[model samples]
Target: MCLLLRLWPVLSLLLLAACDQNQVFEKNADFDSYTWTVQEKPAFEFEIQDTTQRYNISFNVRNASMYGYYNLYVKHQLFGPDGKPISALLHQMILMDPQTGEPRGKGTGDIYDHQFVALRNQQFRQPGTYKIVLEQYMRQDQLPGIMAVGVRVAKAENK
Candidate 1:
C-alpha cells in the first residue's frame, strides 16, 4: 500500500501532463495579406500552451510561384485566451516581399519538391499553452493552386 501511495503522485502528474500535451488547433483562412493566402479550405493550426520547449510546426502548399516552384510562408503566433498575440516566430534567414523591405517569406521549399521540414531548434520559454497561427505567408500571386501543411508537436529536452 505504501508503494501504491507513492506511485499515485507520479501517476497523477503524468496524466495531467499528458492532457496538457493534447493541443487544440483552429483552422483560420483569414488574414490581411494581399500576396499570401490560404486555400479555400481550412489551414492546419495547432493550439498549445507549451512554453517550456519547442514544437515542430509545419504545413504543405501547392502552385506556389509562376515557375511552378513551391514554398511555405508560415507565420506563428502565440495568443492569450483574449486573442491578444503573445509571441511570434521570427525568422533570421529573412525573406523579402517584392515591394517591401520587411522579410515576408515564411518557409522555402526545395526545387520541384514536396516534403517536410523539421524547423529544428524551436522552443518556447514558458510552459503555458498557446494558439499556433499558421498560414501561407506568400505564393504565386498571379495564379491559383494549393498548398498543404503538416506539424508535429514534441517536447523540448529541458522541458
Candidate 2:
C-alpha cells in the first residue's frame, strides 16, 4: 500500500502527459555551466506528417531568479527538410515583470520555467522533418543564469 501510494504521483504525471494529444515534439538542451553563449546554438528537428494541420511553436526557457536582465533576446530560424530557410526572426521574451522585477511562468524557489509562443497557427508547406535553431542574442557574448532552452511543437486547436 505504501509503495502504491508513492507511485500514485508518478502515475498521475504519466497520465497527464499521455493526455496531451496535440503535442508533436518537445525537447530541451541543458547548459552544464548554467550559461548560454553566442556560439552555442540548440537545434530541434521534428517530423510533420500532416502538412494541412496548423501548429503552434513555442520556445522554452529555464533561468535562475538572479538572471541579470528582465528580458531575454533570442534569434530563431526555421528551416524545411530541404535545408531551406522558411522564416527567421529576432524575438524578445520577458522573463520578469518590468516594474516589479517578479519572475514569470512557473517557479520553484530560484529556478523558473517559461514558454513563449513563437509561431501560432502556422502550417507547414511540406510533409517532412522541420528544424528550428535557437541562439542567444543578448549583448554579452556569454549570458548567465540560463540553465536550459527548448522547443515545443503542437497541433493547433481549430477556432
TM-score per candidate, chains pooled: 0.39, 0.89
lDDT of each: 0.40, 0.88
- Could you tell me which 10 consecutive residues in candidate 2 have the lowest summed lDDT? 5-14
Candidate 2 C-alpha lDDT tens digits along 1-159: 766653453355346557899999888899878999999999999999998899999998988887899999999999999999999999999999999999986755677778899999989999999999999999999888998899989999998
Q: What value does the lDDT take at residue 120 in candidate 1?
A: 48
Candidate closest to the true structure, highest lDDT: 2
- Model 1 lDDT vs. the true structure? 0.40
Candidate 1 Cα RMSD (Å): 14.9
Using alpha carbons, what is the TM-score of model 1?
0.39
Which pairs of residues clash in candidate 2, taking residues 3 or more apart in a chain or in different chains? none
User: Considering summed lDDT, which 10 consecutive residues are worst modelled in model 1?
Assistant: 106-115
